[model samples]
Target: MSLNRIASVRAVLGISLTLVLATFFFSPSYSMESRDNSSSPVAGLRVEIKQTSTSPITITSTVVNDNDHTVTFLVYNSPLDTAAPSIGLLTITPDGASEPLDLPKLQIQRQWPPSPESLIQLQPGASQTADIVLKDFIASKIAGKASVALKGRWDMVWNKQKDDVTPEMIEQAQLQAEPDVFSGSFASESVEISPA
Candidate 1:
């Protein structure tokens, strides 16, 4: 083929390839918003639990927000009046134990129609760590390897819509949000521990 003809063919191929890629990336089925809107927020978020000590079973749980927008959640704040709209009990299973130990129950005060100001923010790509207590639930614990995991439930609202929302309005909005009750679990790697 002549030099001019060859150059024209290459340009056409390049444009075609670019258009195909752009279409794929921008398509509704392949876009990020589509996934976030369709799936549970717990699936997008991640949790990692590390057994810091063996004797008392000191666990540090880290929660990661992988969504594109910021998320508002309740932290283990007062243990009394904290709003845990989307978190559930954690499960700890020893290597050979038949029954799993659950995290100690918190005296969570039920505030119907969650307070608008009590929510904590988790920015995109951010993570927060909180110390988890297992001593009360598993007293005189046997020393051995154990696996820790979190079975969490989350009620999430878009950051943009969460601000300035009133409790009265929240109840109705909760039903309309993308992910109202997202249930999922996070499994962490086993960590060695010894009785303190």
Candidate 2:
């Protein structure tokens, strides 16, 4: 082949290789649906509450990953639940009220970026339990039968070191302000809260 023809062939091969590498390495990652697409994280997950004790109610949530792929969750135990700073949301609907009342916000014990230990990973068919105290969750206004619900909003964050997180991700999560990944909202069976 002539010098020019050989040079042209090499240029085309280089370009083709570059495109293949880019498509393979720089392409978007194929991530399984982190959520069940519905407002609930998993179809089988459930929340149970015990209100026998008036001083401190006990709340337990069982999370089951029913999807075919593995999933990870960031379970934050706010100051109300634990002494650490983590992301969480809890609400209660009063017996006679139509709307559920949001849990009172406690002081953020630990500020971001969160430590690696906060990440909870679950394989398919795996389950995890989160036990929280319902002390301040149930208000005196919720007289009679009350319904409890918990919403977990953080799930989209990549499971990696804080350095791997970008400013855009932080802004998207509203990390300092609100939760970005909304796993799902779980409701517990109604329970009676006797009048004080």
Candidate 3:
């Protein structure tokens, strides 16, 4: 092949490769700009339980926000049924304790979203602390062995249209139109609890 033709082909190939790379780099799916900022699906949430007393136990968990946007935490006494759209009791097990802790009777409180209304926005690079006090729930007297397993399904919702909508009116309407996305198996473990 002629030198001139060879050089032209190489130049074209180089340009094509550069364009392809640029397109992938700028694509919304690959770019940070198009990422979802809402609460991520609770696939493998971390949980740690600690035993404070034999009569009563305290469960604290740190829910990490692994998304780019903020997410509100919603805690329910029951597991949410996604298919049927129903609510039921969540099963909880105390650390070193054989029996599972009943969730229906326990009272949960939080500062951000307010009780009877578990709603707290978790910003990117931020985490919220949730503390639950279990009555009649006791931790193991054994040191470092006292822990609880909290198993439950929590629903998560985020308004996607409100991303850049100004004046907030149109955004609100858009949010209403959007369905409330549900996530399940929001389980977590509490730090090991020991007699104080």
Candidate 4:
């Protein structure tokens, strides 16, 4: 082919390839918002639990927010309420057993939508941790066990709607606007622990 003809052919192929790539990458299925609304506040919230110490039988649990927006929610394993039994933080299952250890669950009596000030808000890409001392449940129960697996789950604690919100509730919270509750349960990978 002539030099001019070859150059025109190359330009056409380059333009076609660019359009195809842009269509593929920018499509709704590949967009960040499509994967469970990844741009939403609740997207990619992860929970992780690790055995910190054997003496006190402590477990360090962390909740990481991977989304771009802030998330507001509650955690039973709050630092202030460390002594209280968690609502649905960690579940302990022995290596060979089918049933999980009966860890006490804390029951709260509150209004439908929890107090705005009562909720915990985490910024985008930030993480919150609760170091739980499982001495009461683990030390005695899993004593001398070769290894025990632990799974941590964070459950959405509220069922309130936008209508249930009050004006004063918004003013009291750290979030200036009406906060969308980060709904859904996030579970961590099962971590194996060896107790002495």
**Global lDDT of each candidate:** 0.56, 0.51, 0.46, 0.57
Best by TM-score: 1
After superposing candidate 2 on the true structure, give the runs of residues whose Cα lies further than 4 Å from its correct spot: 1-55, 77-88, 136-139, 155-196
In order of listing, the candidates' clash counts read: 3, 1, 14, 0
Write the residue-wise lDDT of candidate 4 on 26-65 in tens digits. Answer: 9976784464443344346676677788777776767676
Q: In model 3, how many backbone clashes occur?
A: 14
What TM-score would each prediction reach against the true structure? 0.56, 0.49, 0.44, 0.55
**lDDT tens digits, residue span 1-196, model 3:** 9999999999999999999999998987666433432334344333333433444445445566566655554444322221111122324444556775433443344243224243445565566655554443223323334444455655444433223223243335335642344455555444445445
Question: Which number leads on lDDT?
Answer: 4
Model 3 regions lying over 4 Å from their true place: 1-56, 77-117, 136-146, 159-180
Error of 3 at 89 (Å): 7.3
**Winner of 2 and 3 under TM-score:** 2
For residues 86-113, could you state the per-residue lDDT of candidate 2 as single tens digits? 2336666777787876445666664465
Please give the distance, in angstroms, between residue 87's alpha carbon in candidate 4 and its true position after superposition: 3.0
Query: Which residue pairs show backbone clashes in model 2?
Result: 153-181
Candidate achieving higher lDDT, 1 or 2: 1
